[model samples]
Target: MRIAVALFEDAEELDWAGPWEVLAAWARQFPEDDVEVVTVASHDGPVTCAKGLRVLPDHTWETLGAVDVLVYPGGVGTRRELADPVVLDRLRTLHAEETLLASVCTGSLVFAAAGLLDGRPATTWWGLVERLGELGDGVDVRPDARFVDDGDVVTAAGVSAGIDMALHLVARLHSVERAREVRRYIQYDPEPPV
Candidate 1:
C-alpha cells in the first residue's frame, strides 16, 4: 500500500503527523504488509509547518506514483492553496484516479475548493461550518463527528481528531483487534476529548 501524505507551507503539523504516526506504526508493527508512506509537496524541497517544524518531501506532486491513500492536511496555508489552480488540478486528478482521499481539520476546504464536496456532505475545523457552506446545499457538515467516513473519502473534525480517524482506518483495513492493539501500543485508549 502506497500512502502519500501531502504537505505544504504552513500545513497543520498534526494533520500530517498524527495520521503519519498511525500508518507508520502499522507498517512497523506488520512488517509483512508493504505499506510505503511518503511525504509529498507541490515542489521537491523543504516545507515548514505552521508550527515551525521543517520537513523534506520524498517526492513532488508531478512525480508521485499511484497512491492507494492520498491525504491532504490543512493549515493557514490552505486558505490560499485552495485557490491555486495547480493545487486544485492535482487534487482533482488524484480524486479522479479513484484513490481514497482523506483530510483533517480545514483540509476539507481544499476538497471543497476542488469542487469535490460541492454536493457531498462534509465537515471541517468547527467554527467554519457556516462559512464553508459553499460545499453544496444543506450538506450535513457534521462538525461534531470526530471523523466522518463517506466511502472513499474520510474527514476528521479538528487537529487531534485525526488520531481517531487513523485508528478507525486501522480497524477498517485490518481488524478491530488489530486496531485495539495499536491503540493500546500508543496508549490512546478509547476516550473522547474532555
Candidate 2:
C-alpha cells in the first residue's frame, strides 16, 4: 500500500509530521506489509511550513502515481488551497479513485471547499467548527471528536489530534495489535501536564 502525505507551503509541522512518524514507523518495522509512505507536494520545490520548517517533498503531484491513501495536513496554507482550483480538482480526482482521504485541522476546510465533505460527517480545528459548518451544507461537524472516521474520509481535529487519527489509520489498515505495537515503538504515552 502506498500512502502519500500531501504537503504545502505553510502546512502545520505536527499535522503532517506526527502522522508521518507513525506511518513511517509502520513501513519500517513491517516491510513485509509492503507499505510505502512518502510525501508529495504541488511542485518539486522545497515547501516552507507554517513555522518556517523547510521540506523537500518526495514527489510532485504530477509525478505521483496511484496512491492508496492521502493525508492532507492543515495550516495557514490551507486557506490558499481552498481557493485554488488545481488543488480542489486533484482532491476530487483522488476521492473519485477511491483513495482513502484523511485531513488534519483546517485541512477539512479544504475538503469542504472542494465539495468532498458535503453531507458527510467531518471535523476540524475546535475553533473552526462553525466555519466548517458554514463551508459545507449538511456537513455534520463534531466539535468534541478527536477525529471522525467516516469510512473513506477521516477528519482529525486540530493539530496534535492527528497522531490519534494516524494510530487509528494503522489499526484500520492493519490491526489493532499492530497499532499498539507502533504506539509502543514510538513511546507515545501522552500525559499532559497542563
Candidate 3:
C-alpha cells in the first residue's frame, strides 16, 4: 500500500502524523505488508503548518504518482482551502484513481467541498459539523463518531481521534490481530486525565 499524506499550509500535524505513525510502524514490524508512506504537498518544497511546524514534502501532487491511499489532514488551512480550485481538482482526480481516501479532523471539509461526501455519512472536528453539512447538502454529518467509514472514504473527527481511525484502517486492511500488535508497539494506551 502506498499511502500519501497530503500536507498544506496550516495543516494540523497530528491529523497526518498519527496515521503515519501507525501505518509506518506496521510496515516496519510486518515488512510483508509493504506499506509505503510519504508526505505530499500541492506545490514543491516546504509548508508552514498551523502551529508553526515546518515540513518539507517528499513529493508534490504532480510527482506523487499512483497512490493507493491518500490521507488529507485538517487544520485552519481547510477554512481557506475549501474553495481552492487547485486543491479541489487534485482531490477529485485522486478520488478517481486512488483505492481509498481518508481524512483527519477538518480534512473532511475538503472532501465535502470536492463533492466526495455527498449523501455519505462522515465526521469531522465537532465544531465544524454544521459547516460541513452546509458544504454537502445531503451529507449525513456525524458529530460524535471518532471516525466514519463509508467504504471508499473514511473520515475522522478532531485531533487525537485520528489515531483511532488509523488503527481502524490497519484492521480493515490486514487483521484485528495486526492492528492490536501495532497499537501495542506504539504504547498507545491512552488514559487521558481530562
Instruction: Return the top candidate by lDDT.
Output: 2
What are the lDDT scores of the predictions, listed in order? 0.83, 0.96, 0.92
How many backbone clashes does every candidate have?
Answer: 0, 0, 1
Off by more than 4 A, model 3: none
TM match of model 3 to true structure: 0.97
Q: lDDT by residue for model 3 over 63-182, one digit each (tens)? A: 888988888999999988888988888888888876699999999999999999999999999888999999986999999899999999999999999999999999998899999999
After superposition, candidate 2 runs with Cα above 4 Å error: none
Worst 10 residues of 1 by lDDT: 131-140
lDDT at 104, model 3: 96
How far does residue 126 in candidate 2 sit from its true spot (Å)? 0.8
lDDT of 2 by residue, 1-194 (tens): 99999999999999999999999999999898899999999888899999999999999998999999999999999999999999999999999999999999999999999999999999999988999999887999999999999988999999999999999999999999999999999999999999
Expressed as tens digits, the lDDT of each residue in 46-67 for candidate 1 is 8999999999999987788789
TM-score of each: 0.92, 0.99, 0.97
